[model samples]
Target: MELDDLIGIARARWRIIVAVFLSALALASAYVFLTPAQYKSTATVFLSINLDQNNLSSGSYALSQNVASYASLVTTDLVAKQVAADLPDLNLSPQALVGKLSSQVQQGTTFVDVSAQDHDPVKAQRIAQAAADEFRKEVQSLQTGLHAAATDAASLPIKPTSPKTTLDLLVAAIIGLLLGIAGAAIRDRLDKTIRTDKQVESATGAAVLAKVIHDSQASTKPLLTDIGEFASRAEAFRLLRTNLQFVDLDHPPRVFVVTSSVPAEGKTQTATNLAISMAKAGHRTLLVDGDLRRPTAAGLLGLDSSVGLTTVLTGQIDLSKAIQVHPESGLHLLAAGKRPPNPTEVLQTQATRDLIGALREAYDAVIIDAPPLLPVADPAVLASAADGAILVTRHGATTAAQLEVAAARLHSVGARIFGSVVNMVPRPDPGAYAYYMEYAPVANKQ
Candidate 1:
């Protein structure tokens, strides 16, 4: 893959990368600390010919020939047994002594090095010294006229040859980093959620009405227009309000039910903010809590829910008395009062339709906070009464399949869908949201 693609995958799944890397490093650390340390010791032997000055060159060639044979003999059972006899304290058999001993002749020279490796430094040194002594004796016993002499005796090693903590950790970390990156790339490829604007439009075949950036304070500050928190977020709602007006110029959608395929996708908040923005724009907007299953608009607006849509539907109170005006934003709130056991029947009634018609005539706009379409049919039913519906979906959380199903649900009931709103978008990448900056006026900076 390209560098940019790899970086994106890493950024998206950095947690997985960190987890895998730490796990690998921990295992490497355990191995480094638990494994026994090994020490290696070595002894050197030199082979030479005792010859006259006239035959010096020939004697050198003869020693060179004997060196190869002597080196090969060092690993023999005879030499190993002799080494065991030399190091009586070691109590090792010929086979065991040979396992720890290694012999190699220095190239272009009549010299050989015998090395031994073991967990104990003292044993390693003893083995190397005994193996070299045995090898030199064996060469003399061959009666080849070559004199074999010990050049240097084996000495105790101060440090170990294996269990290198730092080097092993470095190698392990590299492996872990590679594994983590690979896993992230695979996960991104397998992800089914629609994360980008192009994906949303491609899935629903509908223009995105608004892209609401994610805000941690959204729930605490539900009404952006309510508290004068006029920032880029507020401007997004205002732009949405303007775009809705332009959606159907001849017959603009004034009565809209904001909903999604599932709960907590920011539909209720969108509906609440949209109504407030409409009111801020000087439009007589009536925000109704149509979500009987989960009525939140009334509580968000701080309005009394003892007498509301239910009271009016039951003929216990007039629709005018059921409505409460927001003292801050001038937006009217009709809470889902006394949540009925059966919201489906309540919204399906002709009285509900009549109430919507009256509200549309009395007010410039009526935005209803309806229940999710997939869970209940209340949203679709309420949409049938309103001019159009606005679908709210959380970016990177809602799958393309869910959006398609939601759109189909509205279409099946013959309800007009004005457009879908992509909500809870990532706020970090302002570079990607340059288009929305045009609508974010200087007066709206938070």
Candidate 2:
């Protein structure tokens, strides 16, 4: 990976990296404390030929050839077994204790180095000394007059050799760092959600009209622009309103349908807030409950919905008289009067088309809160009559496939899609706006 890629992974997954590293370090520390301390000791022995002055050169040549053989015998099972027998108090089997004994010698030298390791320093020292003594006795039994004596005896070591706590911890940290990098890369690959302005444009092939920050009080106060001043959310809707006016310079979209791929993607909320924002901005905005099956616009505005769109469509009441006005926000609402059977048939009628056309001419901007596209053909049918459609999607809650499907459904029928509005996206910090490509690589100096 390049330096930037590694930095990005570490930045995105730093928490996992730190947690794993600390966990490994903690385990290493525990092992150091709980495990018995191991100490190592080595006993040096020097050997030479017992040669007469007349034949010293010949005897030395023979002794040089025998040094390697003697060194090899020092750690053999034969010698190790004897050493084990001498340290019976340690209770180690000959085979189990065999690996701890080892011997080394220099080429053409009359010396052997015997080393031993044990949990107790004193035991290690005793084993090293005893192994050398036994090897000397074996040499004597062979009737070889070669001299052997302890040059430097094993001493008690003050420290342990097995745990190597610092080195082990360093190795563990490296392992943890690798694991974190793998996890971050896998997570980034597996995730298929569209989260950035770039991703939305790439996936839906449409410009973003607005990015509405998530608000906890939106459910209660859905009309963000009803207040006098525009907060961040209100300002965002105002921005959306301004963008809608410029969608077509010759003729802007007066009547538009607000719908999404599936329900609870904040389509209704977007419709209500956009209508209110437009009305508050001195536009005669009318919000119609196009979704007859599930009417939410009326409930959101706290208006009486006993008689509205369906009541007027069926000629039960005049459309003009059925329209209610919100005294606070100056917005108009035409609620879905009653749930009618065969909603698609009712919405597909030419009369429904004519009524929307008439409403479009009556108001400056008309926003219809239509049903979700994939669940039914109602939103598509309604979208056909409207001048344009505003696709609404929630951050992470809506997938790229769903947005594509919704766009394709609208496009198939030759409907005009104005743009998309990303709703309920996380609010950015003072210096943060990373919702879409929310992850950034941290700069790391090597």
Candidate 3:
């Protein structure tokens, strides 16, 4: 990926990265604390060939070649056994002691370095010294004209060689940070939910008319009366009203269907609020709960839903008598009335089309709150009758695939797709929200 792509992923998924990093750091710290500390010490052994007066140059060359071979003998079982016997108080076996022993020839010299590691510094030094001594004795026994002797005694180590706190923590931190970035990149790749206005526009091939900020009080008070006009939620609806009017200049949509791909995506809420915002703007708006399968607009606005749309469609009540005006916002409401068994069949009839036509002539704007598009054919039918469909999708709740499917369903019926509404968007920062609220009233007056 390009640098810009990675940067975007980091910005969007920083929390996941931070969480993974902290977890890895914690694990590394636990390992450092629980693992035993190890101390290391080394002794140097010098190897030289016994030179005859006649062959001084040949003896020196032989010693240089044999120096590496002598270093290898330091790790032998014979050397470990001797060291173990010498340090019997430490209770290390020959096999176990061999694991702690190492040797290497010093470059450009006839010096063999023998090292040993142990939890205790004294033991490490004793083992290194004994291993050097034992290696020298083993070389003498070979009688190959080579002589070996300890040149430097092993020094006592005051600090541990393993579990270097600062270095270990630094390495751990780097590794943890890398893992966290990888995890965040993977998560961002896998997530398919709709999160931004751009994604909605791309998927639905329509502009995002509005982004409704999430409100905790919306469930108890669904209407704008409960949420003041100066609030962000009300401001969002106001923006929706303004955008809807400007979507089509010459032939603007006077009536439209508000629906989503699936239930609980806030389609009902969007329909209710948009109608109130339009009515508050002095437009004679009518909100019809066209979701005969499940009606909620009347209940949301505290209006009588017992005799409305279905009653008028069945010819049981006059259209004007069935429509109720919300006292608070002056928005006309036509409830779903008694749910019919055949909702799809009821909405597909000519009566439904005629009702939409009649409402379009009577009101400045008519918003029909329809059921989810995927589960039933009610919304597609309603959209076909109305001017267009305003698909309402919840932020992070509706997947791209679901939104695409809903848009395709609307397109199949040749329904006009005006635009989309993104619901329950994350609230802006507190300072920004307060600033907007403080100045919104003055902006409205202007």
Which prediction has the highest lDDT against the true structure?
Answer: 3
Cα lDDT tens digits, model 1, 153-257, are 998999998998889999999999999888888888888787776777776667888988787777677778544444668868978998898888777777998
- Runs in model 2 deviating more than 4 A are 1-77, 99-152, 214-232, 426-429, 432-446
Tell me the TM-score of model 2: 0.77
| Arranged by lDDT, best first | 3, 1, 2
* Candidate 2 lDDT tens digits, 1-446: 78887786566556767877787777777887788888988888887777779888888888788777877777678777887788788777767666777788855588788888888888888888888888777765654667787788877777888888778778877886787677777775676666667667776678999999888877666777444353567767878999987889998679999999899999998999899888988999899988988898888888987789889999999988999998778999999999999899999999999999999889999999999998999988999999978999887678888989999899887788888999888766644444322332232222
User: Which scores greater on TM-score, model 1 or model 3?
Assistant: 3
lDDT tens readout by residue for model 3, 1-446: 99988887787778888898888788879878988999999999888777678897978987787778778888889888888888889899999999999999999999889999999899899899999889999988886777887889999999898888778888988988898889988988898999877789998999999998889988887778887768788888888889888888999889989999999999998999899889988999999999888898888888888999999999999998999999988999999999899999999999999999999999999999999999998899999999999999999789999999999999999998889999888775689888887887788799
- Answer with 1 or 2, whichever has the higher lDDT: 1
> Per-residue error at 47 for model 2, in Å?
8.0
Candidate 3: where is the Cα deviation over 4 Å?
Answer: 53-62, 215-223, 228-230, 427-446
Worst 10 residues of 1 by lDDT: 435-444
**Worst lDDT window (10 residues) for model 3?**
221-230
